[model samples]
Target chain A: MNTQTIPPLAPDAPVVLEMTNISKSFGAVTALVDVSIRLRQGEVLALVGDNGAGKSTLIKILSGFHQPDTGTIVSQGKEVRFASPRDARAHGIETVYQDLALIGDLSVFHNMFLGREYHKRVLGLNLLDNRKMREQAQLYLDTLGISIPSVNSTVDLLSGGQRQCIAVARSIYSSPKILVLDEPLAALGVRESAHVLGLIQNLRQQRQVSVILIVHNYNQIFEVCDRINFLHSGEIALDASTADTSEEELIRIVKSGLGRKAIDAAAAQVRPGPA
Target chain B: MPPTAIQPTKKNAVGVKVPRTMREQLLILLSRYREASIAVVAIVLVIYFQLGSDGGFLSPSFMSVVLRDTGRLGLIATAEVMLMITGEIDLSLSAIFSIAPYIMALLSVTYGVPLAVGAVIGVLIGILVGAINGIVTVRFKVPSLITTVGTLFFLQGIVVSIYNSQPIVAPVEQPFNAIFGQSLYQPTDALLSWHGVTAFTPFLWALLVVLVLALVLNRTTFGLHTIATGSNIIGAREIGVRTDRMKIYNFMIAGGCAAFAGIINTAQFTSADPQAGSPFLTLQAIAAAVIGGTSLLGGSGTVIGALIGAFVVASLNNGLVMIGAQATVSDIYLGAAIIAAMILSIQVDRLRTRRRV
Candidate 1:
């Protein structure tokens, strides 16, 4: 109920995604209440909240894993209902979960192609076009500035950062209009985190895709995100441009569950930088 | 480091760099195909057994018998490999193998059904039982090992009760028997004297099956998805893979193979024994797959490796018998071989990891 608005960073940019007044419940448990968020074209918007703050519920709705009890989701001005994850994918909304969803036993190209494999018809059988997949996977990686030893290398042998990069690359290769990344840096080390952060930054600079990043680390959010949406107790508490907010202010707002007036009062006292 | 360790890379005519040394090349090959080590072990075993048996192990007639055993066991092992690669196991496959032939024999002899139709029904029953196992495992969330074991006992009980714990002797006519299991070419001194090899139909069928399944596993999207389903079910699902359906399809494939193997056995012997479906047979099939380099943990395996493994197992049994060793001694060797293969596979994995690092 205490949703604070910040001036849009790119006012002229089209809103690629809009979720308004979305509410969801599981049996007796109300997971989300009147949550709404908007993603502008080519903007990286970070959704930051503590545990049990309905960040996952909002994400699940966006990814088509769960349908909202109430509210509408509009993509490019047309309202859409996602009955399943496949439907969401069909609409070009790709989500890379915390696990990265890459099969370890498969080669890089195979993982890149996983469910949506390229196939060539052979004697009425749709056989895998492995050569095409390998070439395309390598080309996609190169275009994304991701460096790996080979597309033929099994994914399990790759480093954590490399695996995350592959998962991101796979989503991007699908040419999703909106990319959702859930805790991509949570399991990675500092150097690996930097690698992923750099990739996100590169994506923002080089691609037309909009990103909704769900992260806990405020420093990472500030480093790569153009805006931040803070969720508190199944509600959006703060919506502000990353340039207009400091990490300390975001932390205070999240820790205190501040009302809109208090958040604005707090925001006025702090400079928008590292503490 | 030794000077030999620092070999220079060579460029082929295509201008691509190639591994400079045989050691490096071998390592590269081994890493790319985990089954290569098992293939080597099988070859070494064949040679060792041939020498130990004074070349009797390699005699055409004895080799035919060994290959026949390989054919039957390889079919089941191939089934296990398919299911295993999808992170499932069908303990009831041997039971399906046992009952399918019985169904065929009963239908053909007692009910006067056509032999070909009976055989098809027998395989269909196997596939049906597999579907049941798959449905129970996926829909009910029962572990496949448990679900299939339940089916195994249930099917075994049905076989016992129906057959009264007796063997049915069904006289299969010519051509049908020949197509299924009878020897295609029996090399004798008078005919094809120079060839010196016997070709059993079952062995040929096994070869064909292995070749086809190998292609399916390596070249098809279904195969890749199966591997992905086994490797990481959660991950596979997240990526829109029908993980449960894949597991079910693999279970069905395992069932079909088991039933086909059983039908082959019936054709070869002209009889179906109710008590033939045993857990020991199931364990042996699993062992063959494991020895052939199929991972018990799943996500990685090859049908060809399993077939070779079947040959290795059959050779051990036949070679031991040829050398006049006790039947129990082959069991001891088999147990040791399984352990050795697992250790070697682990070491090879570690080597790959170390090299990658």
Candidate 2:
């Protein structure tokens, strides 16, 4: 309803990744239609939308869980196709999915280095460098100001906030160019959510890592995000800078996408139309 | 600032510890030493058998026999635990165990191939069968239980039809019998033997395999990926873990272990019984793992636990026979042992989870 005022890209800001004319369909249900979004280096972009607004589908496509029916993805100005999650990761794109980012049964250090374990060569056998991993895990958590009993503690035994912190920390360990997190704060308590929001802000400012975060909370979007992309009915309904938008405006835009049906219902009631 | 940095001095929320109840303390103690609890139960059973049996079950010779059987079963269970933790099951392992030795015997005896080379080829075939099971389950999107069950029957049928329900026998020769199936230190003179003094043949192999696998599971990247993939498949995939490949590799390892077990049995007896290890053997191996504290649901297991569990099963089997129990009764006892182990593990897991909360 309001004019979209996306901030102009800075001259020195390089484009990290661009998904152009992306469209995908699952059977007869069109999930995404001609959606285009670009991430600039060192920017925290927030993707916010109501349920079934194709937010997850877009995230899945970016994370290489699902391929777009029609689209071209350019990473660092080079054309690329991610056939699998490994391919996406190879291009320095890491995604931490919500809820199950870390193995619950594994210790914090083990989860932190799940696929990429540190091993020392001993008698030609690749044995785990557990001491090194444990120390590094402690250092990373300490640097992030996360307090847990120990790195050897299983993640399932940890609080919801601590588990989330470990997941975020693990993603950052890869030094990825673009980190995509799908609903990192969902189901967390208010205080836990605040902690995660702070972690995101710290990541953006200190690490200078580009992020594409999907979240339902508008307050979180406003607090830590630089840019916002709103999806309504399989399309980018609003794309703007956080400085140019407010919570009231976001709610209004979200409501207006379904406003036509509401208006039709109101007219039907006023005119006393037959059921 | 992060929430931790703020350190909100909320009244009554900081470091107020309450004394734990007696039950809580007991649960913590039990869960922390669940393996030790199982080991205690196993030791009691051995003592019970030693007292009841006509022959001294605790005698050095008899104990050695029991350990040798335990070792063979333990090796297979160790392999199964790995697959189970990956959220997959391999029923065809017992089938592979039964048939691989026959293949080795046929190659060595009929084809006049080197015994060692034949054994190696047999084990490789077993690995191939496991790979097929993994590929079908992962690539074709079939449940592993179903895929492995189908493979079990298929392999079993091949072995039965080819061998015509006949046992294949080979001559007991030097080196072949010396390395596997037989005792580690053979007696030169009857008066002063050191067979049990060192280690039994198959048990040594079992111990070696168990130790190596335990290391691989706990101290390697493969182990990390295994736990990750088993714990959360979607989470692992999101982190770029190649879970399908990991499962396939695990299946192959399991198959190879079964083959090794089969070779040990064949070398020990100097015969390859086409129907040696049945579906019952598979059940025994799984029962051993479950008793050892490996979860059926996946993502949590240990080789040490499986090894202990195998000892428990071996004790039950050997004890029953020594106590003059009917052959059918031994099966009943095994079934009961499995149920008991499952109950114990479930309780231990419940306590551990409760402690977390």
Candidate 3:
């Protein structure tokens, strides 16, 4: 249920990546069908949908966890397909997963540098260069007007919001051109959700960065994102700018069955989440 | 409380907090104090035995045997503790230990090589065995319990199979045999008469292992990784630790140490018996680790504690044997002790975690 819908996006927001005619199926289930959306650099595009709306499937395909059966993914005007998340990473695309997928026992620095560790050796390999990793981890956090005082404290000690922030920091640390977030604020309290939305807003300030956030929180979508796309039953039913749309339209699009009556009924009864 | 106060308590959510009685708390604490309590028990037994005899248990001769016998076991225990910390069990270490000296014997006696060169090669062979075990465990991602158990059987089979494959046993030379089997000094009457045993270099070897392993576990990054990996794989992975590398390396280290132990055993005897290292597999290594305070469940433990645990187990064996107890009886008691140690550690860890809240 959405009470306040977003308006249309401004013309200045440049599209950085686009997936056209995307279709995906698992055996015979057909989880996604003919879905497409464009993401713009220095702009936030919030993917709004209900449960079983094929949001997960769509993002998984983009993140390289799943491959779309038929689609042309054009990134910065060049078509591409990723065989794995690691492959996507090489092309400057990163995802901050919902679970945070961080090493809970590892220090903040180690978690950020997970997999993509920096090392110095006698001739470019060998030695772990732990001192340099720690110094650089501090520098990365400092750039965001945040500081993890100790690079040594395990990630488990941080609160839920801080952990999400840390995951975002880690994704941005590699300076990826496209960032995808999956339901980041779902489990967070009101204050934590606000902080995360603020961080997203700050991220939008970076000119070369583009973000696609998959969230059920439409209020959060309106607060932070410039445009919105709605997925229903494996298809994009509504694609509109936040500046021009209303939550009633989004709810109607969501609850509208195969008839006019359901759409009218849904439009009449739209009530957003909490106070 | 004010609305904005941090802990906004809900009346329905609060449960009755019952404080445990003094007797219950004492029982809990006693259970928590594992190796130390066991050590105390060992001390009590020693005191009792000493008082029962013409104070022989209190005599330097008896204490020396305890220390020297406990030393070999202590080395194996340290190695076992290190592996346990990394959440992998190298049940084959016992077999590796027994097979090592045989390798040395073959090199020294069959090839007619110098003892020093044979010994160095033997050490390398031991390291190789450990590394291979590490590789296999990491590659397959199999439960180490099953993998190492298989290796234990395999290594033991190999030890027996190739024990005399080269048909070799080095002749016991003066200093070579003395370093392994004899004490540096003994209280003896004038004539250099026979009928005496002394503390061996194997004892010193055990002590050195304890000191070195304790420092490595407490101070090194490798040690930290071992703890991290065992704590939670996801937690360790999120931070980007190659837990796989840590475990395999740990298994290798354990294997290498066991091989070195085998060499010590063979040098001490100055002869390689195909089946000599057999009993050592579980009885000594596991007992030592348990006594040293290493948790088989992994994550937490200390090397010094394991050393102490080793001594306790060794002393238990020596004491029971002295009192004419059978080998089977010793095994039963050893099993009981290890089980008790494990249970106590678990309960204590839970208590501490709960107290943190």
On TM-score, the leading prediction is 2
Which of candidates 1 and 2 is the stronger one according to DockQ?
2
Q: Which ranking of candidates, highest DockQ first?
A: 2, 1, 3
The DockQ scores of all candidates, in the order shown, are: 0.39, 0.40, 0.17
Where model 1 places Cα greater than 4 Å from the true spot, the runs are A1-14, A20-31, A66-72, A77-79, A186-207, A257-275, B1-29, B183-199, B354-357
**lDDT, each prediction:** 0.83, 0.80, 0.68
In lDDT terms, how accurate is model 3?
0.68
Which residue runs of candidate 3 sit more than 4 Å off their true CA positions? Answer: A1-40, A45-96, A100-180, A206-212, A227-241, A244-275, B1-71, B163-168, B171-221, B290-293, B320-329
lDDT of 2 by residue, B1-357 (tens): 133444344321212122278876666666666577678888888778978985478766677778888988998999999999899999998899988988988887888887788789989998999899999999999999999999999999998888698988866466778677764333342324443434476887888999998888888888888877788887877777899998999999999999999988898888888898899888899999988878888887888888889998888887888888875686787788788878877876776675662
Assess the local accuracy of residue B216 in candidate 2 as a C-alpha lDDT between 0 and 100: 87
Candidate 2 fnat reads 0.58
Scoring model 3 with DockQ, what do you get? 0.17
Better of 1 and 3 by lDDT: 1
Across residues A1-275, which tens digit of lDDT does each residue of candidate 3 receive?
A: 33333233455756678899999989989888898888877767788777777888888788776889998898888899978676777777888776676755456776677676565554432444567778888787767744333565556555566677678778878777888888988766676566666667666664456789998766677777777777767876656666666655675566555443554454344332111
Model 3 lDDT per residue over B1-357, tens place: 012433334221112123367745654454445556667767777776666554665555566677765766776777778888777777777777767777777767777776666667766776777777788888887778778778788877887787443435656565666655554335552223332433446777777777777655644456656777876665454344578888878777777777777666676556666565564555577777775567776766677777777777766766676666675687787888888877876666565444311
Residue B237 in model 1: shift from native, Å? 0.8
